[model samples]
Target: MDEQGVRGSGSPPTGRFRRGAAWWRSGPPWVSRWGAEGGRDGGAAWPWPSTLLLTVFVLVGSSFAAHGQEGERAALDPFARVLLLVAAGLLLWRRRHPVAVLFGTSAAAATYLGAGYPYGPVFLTVAVACFSAVVAGHRRAAWAAVGALWAAHVLVAHWLYRWLPPTGDAAVSWGQEAVVLAWVVAIMAVAELARARREQWARDRAERAQAARRRADEERLRIARELHDVLAHSISVINVQAGVGLALLDSDPEQARTALTTIKAASKEALGEVRQVLDNLRAPGEAPRAPAPGLDRLPELVTQAAGAGLTVEVEGEPPRLPPGTDLAAFRIVQEALTNVVRHSGSRHARVRLDKAAGTAGDPRGAALRLCVDDDGPATGADAGGSGNGLAGMRERAAALGGTIEAGPRPDGGFRVLAVLPLDGATAKEGER
Candidate 1:
């Protein structure tokens, strides 16, 4: 009845097309409750060619059956042709009003047979309606309508024929009814198989949609963390230098000029990094204008901290690293230092890097340890930070099969410690 197939691909209609589609999908409440089945267009209009063809076939075929039956049944007349027309025409609404069509077609068929019209392809209309209703999930209605029709036909053929049209006819045998029952069962069985397949396709589509949404959400979170690490550290440095410049604008003009230059450099660097991040967002597959910052840029961090009135010391040489691990490592250190400048009163901090188990003769990948510490009593400013920074740090580390620990030190200030695998393969092997 609704052979248009499964729902359309996921790109939804838009503008007037979308509105018109919504209107099509809407229908009478009873149809929804009956669980009518159709294409995405909601069985909006009649299937004219198919319905007309069926009506023509049944009319011609019934005429031949009537001629052969002669006196055994009533002759085909205007009333008999009207019954055929009614049964076939009901199929036009089979997809949108399945249950109604099922009963309507069966009723017309039953009345025609009760009046003693010869048996013919007029039963085809009833079979089509029954198939549509069963596939549309109106199983009980489809079964009842066909079942009641068969029972009524049995009563008419065996006993009631004496009181009905074409009097003096003998009762028909039971073997014919058994054949009719077999046809009914076969039709319902095929409809059930189709319904199961449709439901499975719907389930698969839902799971795929859910997985796609999950991936999109994770990408957005990663980009947000990237933007935060880039802007927060540079902005803090600019804020500190601006304060120093303002304090000595007239009293110490030369020192003030130096502070102004530091702010300019910090702002320019921040802008360049922000633009780079945006470039990746806008044209993801294109090569970057510049490489990502890594341990090689550690000196720049030291110089920026100096402008912010803090002294930072480096303790170990940077290790050879994978590109992903290198970018994650740089962001972790940057976030840790930003926390130190904003939350700790101490003017000094230390950074240490170590290849925990690597050596010239070792063939296996090694873990890299990073530590940032400051001597502090809390400054209490917190710089209005949103508190996502430390959580972001932990998430980045965990993503690469690494760990991070950040808290106040037992002896004096705060510390951020991280240990990361050299590469993804090493991380997975370690996990195993």
Candidate 2:
């Protein structure tokens, strides 16, 4: 085959050859045509065999051609013809064991050259072997082998004809060889870069998916904490009232009726709160319900604690708060007082809410502070160590852009202090 036919043949079908063929075909029309044909016919699988067969056919045809010039011979010698046949046989195993095929073909070509074979057909076989190596993902090995073969070619050619130096016409030939080698290297590099980029994209997509899942889990946990804190406190109060009613049934009918009334009221309120929470979960698209207990409900909350047999006191005017901050402030005080009733072993507790001008001197915002103190014994224990109660309180405050500190007070009590942002764009304008 002519050089144009050889170069135009592009790559082959299947494996790495298909990738190379697709890349090469993305060029001019001639390359595309050859690539389409070669890729469809698996030309890359046994390229050397196909090339050698074509060479033999051409040589035979050339022998029959009219040649008026004197001392004109065929394009290949007898030994060279035999070597090409051997190289063709080796091509069958190229894909399975490209390294072995490359070495075998290289040795045969060198021997054919040593025996004075015509150089053209032998060079084509060497190029096909090198191409096979590249398609097998062994570009470095192919380059190394080609370099060794070129060095050997220079030495052998010089020994055969001593007057020929390594430069001049030979140097020009080497330059052309270097260009071909560079082209092959570029192809391999491009493939490597494409593969690397694909892997990076996959990794980034996986990380984003993981982040989404984590956020969903956190939201679910927050909802669960809300349900537990609200329901547990209401149930505890109902349980206390019911016990009181049972104890007074025979001794004092009037007191028993009052206790029963308190139980019914607490139960109804607890049921309403629970239904509202469930509705929020089921219909997130629905309009939000009226805001839960905030500063306005502080007095009612304090009254309930007093009814539960704890002396409760309130101090300071709390700032108007954003909806979320308001809910968080109420939850903090509610949880602190609940702990006092359940575990403090104390009779009196104090709640103080304050709003003041910012220490940073910003006109647009103010600080809302809450402090709940109980004259309970030093129950020096980790909040998390006991139950989810205090942890739920902390999470509530933190979610509303606030900070909470809870521990035993130095003066024989437990104190919880939460500072929340108020007077922001979200807060009512006239109230700050």
**Candidate 2, residues 272-356: lDDT per residue as tens digits?**
8888888888997897585576777888777777666778899987666667777778877877777776666677999897886
Report, for all candidates in order, the number of backbone clashes: 0, 0
Error of 1 at 351 (Å): 2.3
Which ranges in model 1 have alpha carbons more than 4 Å from their true place? 1-75, 118-121, 157-178, 357-366, 423-432
Go through the candidates in order and give the C-alpha RMSD of each one to the true structure: 10.2, 16.6
* All candidates: TM-score: 0.78, 0.58
- Using TM-score as the measure, the top candidate is 1
lDDT of 2: 0.63
Question: Residues 1-432, candidate 1, lDDT per residue (tens digit)?
Answer: 000000011023321222233333433333443222343454544455677789999999999998899988899989999999999988878877899999999999999999989999989999889888887889899889989999998999888988989777788888988898898898888888877887788889999999888868877888888888888889989888898999999999999999999999999999999999899989989999999888888888888998999899999998878766788888988888877787778899999998877667744457889999888756666365765788788878887878898776778677789988774634553442
